[model samples]
Target: MKEIQQFFIRNFIAVPVSFGSWLYLLFGIGMNIFPATGLFIVLYLGSSFSIKQIQLSSNLKQLGMTRSEYKHIKNQLTSARFKVKQLNSFYGKVRSVQAFRQLHEINTISRKILGIVKTNPKKFYYVEKFFYAHLDSAVELTSKYSMLVNQPLKDKDLKITLQNTRETLVDVNKQLEQDLRNVLSSDLEKLQMEIDFVGVTMNRDKPVLEMKGDKYNDRK
Candidate 1:
């Protein structure tokens, strides 16, 4: 939602301002329409990009992160998101109900984790294992399992490998759940802190609030 808001804000700030310059160049100075349009495109793109970067820097500062840290986390998140999309390709490749269910669980958990971090990039530090390790494991092992499951005639070795892959996917699923738990635990901690703060505020201000009741409460 914040990202969507930023998109609109960037365009709103950059578009008409850039277009005004274009209007001046084409009409005020009577420059050729073609060159003026070209310059307008360039100016619009540059200003839009600059505004986005400024917003990003400001947000990163508020998050107490350096630009380098933000880029690192964002890169990992982009990679992980791409890999999650790849998981969809396996749905048609998988056969058994168990295999499909396992893949679905992993994909669902991964997306939820990624959604949380993408919304609050600072949480990446708390759940690095999902982006760094377990997600890769889930994608790679699922691919391998799909291939093995598709074999026309499986030898005893192939069957054992399939079992091992399934077991590994189970572990991956659990780790994804753990990563989610870690992220949610952070949210839970923040919520508890807020609740504690509200309790304190009520206790400390109750008398004053009662004394001043109906004074300024409804106006604001």
Candidate 2:
């Protein structure tokens, strides 16, 4: 029932509401049928502007804010990639250890926890391209993390925890990368299936909407 309601709202209610408003604005105001387009303008603004919708139901089951986290992680990765590309372009060099560390930091936090939590294999594959595109940088980053983890230190427990975290992160990245590569074909196929579903539904209902619009205009 909820899904059907949502579908109706998205296609039937929302689109028609938007179209009616724009039509009133373009026609009713231009034709001097009303004192002003103020009412239509208000409704247009209200409906067109998006409110931040947190799907609390899905989040409760998923354990994380999926879209927000995905956007943040993607931004981080893109920024890192840009910086590395800039360095290589300027100096004709590969990468610095510190630069690699920054890359590693972004990847470790992005994949080890957030990416896995999202559980979207297609997204994982897309992100893997980001890593693979900078394979040299990634290898260097892994080496630097390895060195950091192996460094002898006085605080044994703290060192152990940090090493364990680093190793775990590394293992997770490798495993996920392989999984992404292996499933790329199937995941992409699934994406197409979803796209086809949306396309068919949209095509099926478009004429019904046109008919409704004609009726609404005739009534006016």
Candidate 3:
């Protein structure tokens, strides 16, 4: 949808540039309609494509990554998004209100983690387990839990399995929370460093101001 919007904007901008020349060739120069139409189409398409490539390069530069690195990060994000979608799908299958809420919490955490890494593609490295194993575990366990919860028979053993699944999901939720912390750790560290630097700068200036105040008082 975003791409479509961009394409529309690009072509809208490209139209006047291409159309004026095409019109001159067709009407003013009395050129053949068929050839002029062909040239116009080619020019229009080429201009739009150039606009797209320029925008793509600009985006890659802003992200501080090469085209290949950007593509790799994008692919990883796409895969991670699919896993999150899978986790969300289980919510409807969940029978118990407790189970539904549990799945919602897990999905919420997954989304937060995904959103953070997405904006800073470099943070994708910080969440290997999240992209690979931990998320898969959540989806798989949820699948089993959802399936079993909807089963018609609730035997003694089945009840035990359900309880175990719920307990396991709690553990998975904790792991997801840990994953969120892991992704944010560097950001948190940077923030604290900034805060400390500001504090130290203020403290260092305080003594100078105090000495100046003392001199001013003596003169007074």
Candidate 4:
């Protein structure tokens, strides 16, 4: 589904606009009224404009993203998702329960981070470094591990390789969790500060009444 959407965004306008231009050129040729060079120039310019418009519209449709924001973070977003997709592609090939579990965890964390980025693209800057540093390694290691475990022979070295990959994946999972925390750190701090301020204000604004009961008893 995602691949289809990406293909559409890339070609939806370019193909149709280019084809329409060709049709116009053919019609003009049939009528003997259009200059070939002029028609070619128009087609080139129109196709370029159509491509730009489609890209702009696709970027705008991204939640919490402006054109500038999308441009700034597009690579990071694309890279992260590409890594996730790479890991997902190995899902069916995962033979061991441990490998399957690790892949599932990786996919879940990757998707969670992707979801956060989608909703709060401004935080993409915070996460961009982490994704660049670790995402590729995680995907590669997971893929290698999946392939290793799926082999029919269980050699001593294969067992060691599997163990080492599993261990590395545990570290990768920790890094992913840390990345998520880093992305949310500012918001979490803001929420904590607000809660503290409200608590203090409520306590300070509470009225203290001690003499009212005594006054009623005295009047009686």
Best by lDDT: 1
* Tens digit per residue, CA lDDT, model 3, 107-179: 9989998888777877877887888888889999999999998999999999999999899999999999999
lDDT against true structure, model 1: 0.91
**Per-residue alpha-carbon lDDT of candidate 2 for residues 93-182, written as tens digits (9 for 90 to 100):** 223464345445545443443344244422544555444544444444445444555556638776676566456546545654554454
Stretches of candidate 2 exceeding 4 Å from the true structure: 1-35, 46-153, 187-220
How should the candidates be ordered by lDDT, best one leading?
1, 3, 4, 2
Candidates' C-alpha lDDT: 0.91, 0.51, 0.87, 0.76
Q: Which candidate do you rate higher for lDDT, 2 or 3?
A: 3
Model 2 lowest lDDT segment of ten: 86-95
The best candidate in terms of TM-score? 1
Q: Worst 10-residue stretch by lDDT in candidate 1? A: 208-217
What tens digits encode model 4's per-residue C-alpha lDDT throughout 18-61? 66666676675563435644665576667767766666676578
Per-model TM values vs. the true structure:
0.85, 0.28, 0.78, 0.64
